[model samples]
Target: MPGTYPVPPGGGRGAGPATVPGDLLAELDRLLAPSVRSLRHSCAVDLTFGGSLAPGSRDAITIRHLDGHLGHTLRDLHVRAGYGLGGKVFSMGRPLVVRDYFNTAHIVHAYDRAVAPERIETVFAVPIRAGETVVGLLYLAQRDDVAIGDRIVARAVEHTRRIERDLAVGVEVRRRTAAYDEAATRDHRAVADARRDLDEAISLVGDPQARRRLREVSQRLHRITAGDDSAPQPAADGVLSARELDVLQLVATGAANGDIAAELGLRPNTVKAYLRSIARKLGATNRTHAVSLARESGLLP
Candidate 1:
């Protein structure tokens, strides 16, 4: 996790929050709201909201991903540890339920002003975790005091678990992509070194034939395998320029704009311009979608 999410300043998770992969957080922004919607639909709940421990947030669980929300009740609400229903879950690392949210003696009314707007009653809060790390949380609520029974609990857990699995996969992909890039960089350097040496050798040769033979070898050295030369790579569907392709490749690895700019020797603003163009040409709604579209279009490997 190159962009490690720091733990909530000395108060949230005692041992420090888990270093969530930036890819996982980005994926959550793309994936979690849909998961919450599905759960709400399947369970027939009145309201569903998904929350993630966003980067740079110290102790609030107010970073709702998207629209599973019923109203503006929870907007601008920062539920910290030991406060609201969500904060308690973040602190306790376990699911909690209240048959009547306002009347319950179990949790505080920190978000009461906010929660009051939805007129929500019984609420079920589950920690959206990957292994033991609590990356985020899922909430299921209704306007009435529905029984916080096995069925509701089971449904919420199952859906949240799927989200957890997705988070895990995103983290794994981030790890593998970084590893692959590191190896590829090393191989590139090796190829460059070999070609430099070959060029030096070719220059020293007296015979034109030997020099030509060495030059041919030097040209082929950059190819990963002999088979790569046999088939031409598919032309990018959008005909993305070389710089655009470079930006997208880094995007696929979940690199932030600053990192991508640094790698490509461009200004941050220039990187943003490239991304906007990439998104428009690809018809991609977001960064994650752009990478997916590029891969599907065979514009990326």
Candidate 2:
């Protein structure tokens, strides 16, 4: 029900062309071709990815790539939720098939103009979901009334799962990149603020002892604000191993121990050992303090 709605054509927020990359389209084309062959379908197959067209409107799935068929009607066609065969799949977030598209009373023939010209009688659609959200649909079709068997459906589902895994990974990579960028910006601001405060303190102080303490603090902050080349290197003493550094870097990115283990191909226990070693080397009482010391000591960037 959430992904089912129909509004005027090209009237939604994403009315323009979707920002799908060429490499992803190419990969989808490659995967679709093999899937059609493996399913032993004599007709054409294509992939349509769903994206938001406007706020509060259901996402429309558009034909991005096809392995077969010459009709321009099917190409670039936007399928809305609860409208046609693909729409039903999009709304339900699962696989659906109509042996006879025109004759089927189960789904509305909203896109008969496109389907009739293509002469596609049977259609099978599977939803490609990333996490809990359905992101796209994969379709296998035939020009004749052929019953889609269980084996073919199963194989198509498997391919959709593989595609979903790739999409999920891409999403995670983008999220982490954004997080790192925000963190870097915050670190720069913190360094500038520290320098400004130090300058103000030195100017305002009249006592000789207090002035010396301010200078010491200024020197410490300078070491942190300066580039790694000017700062004292931590690796020279071999205090923290390369593996421990790897764990700390991910930890600074807000990764849990389990995620660090998965990323570094280590056990959870091994990740804990690395963290303990890093904390001991930095003389930090906790993980947060350890990360602070690492950044200050030029062990992390």
Candidate 3:
């Protein structure tokens, strides 16, 4: 009996690094502590996870300040575009500071309700970018200071640099995960196509004996494509001959050159030739790519 495709057992897709960088947050607290050292002030960081604004808002100014306090809890109050401090920061990647809490022309008054309740005085906002992409903003506020100086702005930028590094790492991890997901999706589509071919073969063939054999082949192919059939199939790209396909299948299933040689009843040197030939036929630069393509094309399950 034909073996099933080796399905790497299903697990929920991993969301890369659920919690933000603890060390970075610690560093931020340490760095910002000096700025607000005299009177207790809070430092907050907020970001856009690409989708909609959580509750705090999407507009950068609102997201930076509002979410920092409430942690974006109120979906209804989410800042919209070009409305508040978050909006200004979103548009301008630089930092903005207001010494006196009550008066700032650089930003909108949309956050006045929340500010009035919080009794906020002075506010500073800075845009945090992952490279050129402005993902969110950072805000620091103090009720006493009417305006902050250059030193505080410099420290805030330094803090941003550290946080940006962490955010970049997170972005790279996400990119790799997305690439894997795309590859998996492509493999699934290929299997569906192969199954359709098998079904057509079984349906089109004539004679009871031939039809039974075809049906069996279809069932076996279905099992493999659906991840039930055991053993990986040979890699074929429509270019490889049947013998070449046989040679590659074993290679992909962790067979070494000599082991493939033994299985195919060919000399080790001959197996090497077959591998080279198969790679050329499949337009694969190396064995690994060849295997991946084979798997994706339903040449191997």
- What would the TM-scores of all predictions be? 0.66, 0.53, 0.44
Best-fitting candidate, scored by TM-score:
1
lDDT of candidate 1 over 1-301, digit per residue (tens): 0111112111234113556666666776677768877888888888888777666553556647434466776855667767878887777777776767787766777778888878888777777665666767778887886675677778778777778787778878888999998987887787778778876776677654454445446545634433254432222345678999999999999899999999999999999999888876665658897787566556687
Q: How many residue pairs clash in each candidate?
A: 0, 2, 18
lDDT of 2 by residue, 71-130 (tens): 667766788877887777666666777777787778888999887877777777776654
Ranking by lDDT: 1, 2, 3
Measured on C-alpha atoms, candidate 3 has an lDDT of 0.52
Q: Candidate 3 lDDT, tens digit per residue, 187-295? A: 8788778878876765565554454344445445565556765633323323567887898788778789888888878998988888887765554558887776455
Evaluated at residue 270, the lDDT of candidate 2 is: 95
Model 3 residue 260 CA deviation in Å = 45
Each candidate's lDDT (Cα)? 0.70, 0.62, 0.52
Which of the two candidates, 1 or 3, achieves a greater TM-score against the reference? 1
**lDDT, residue 13, model 3:** 17
Task: Name the lDDT value of residue 134 in candidate 1.
Answer: 70
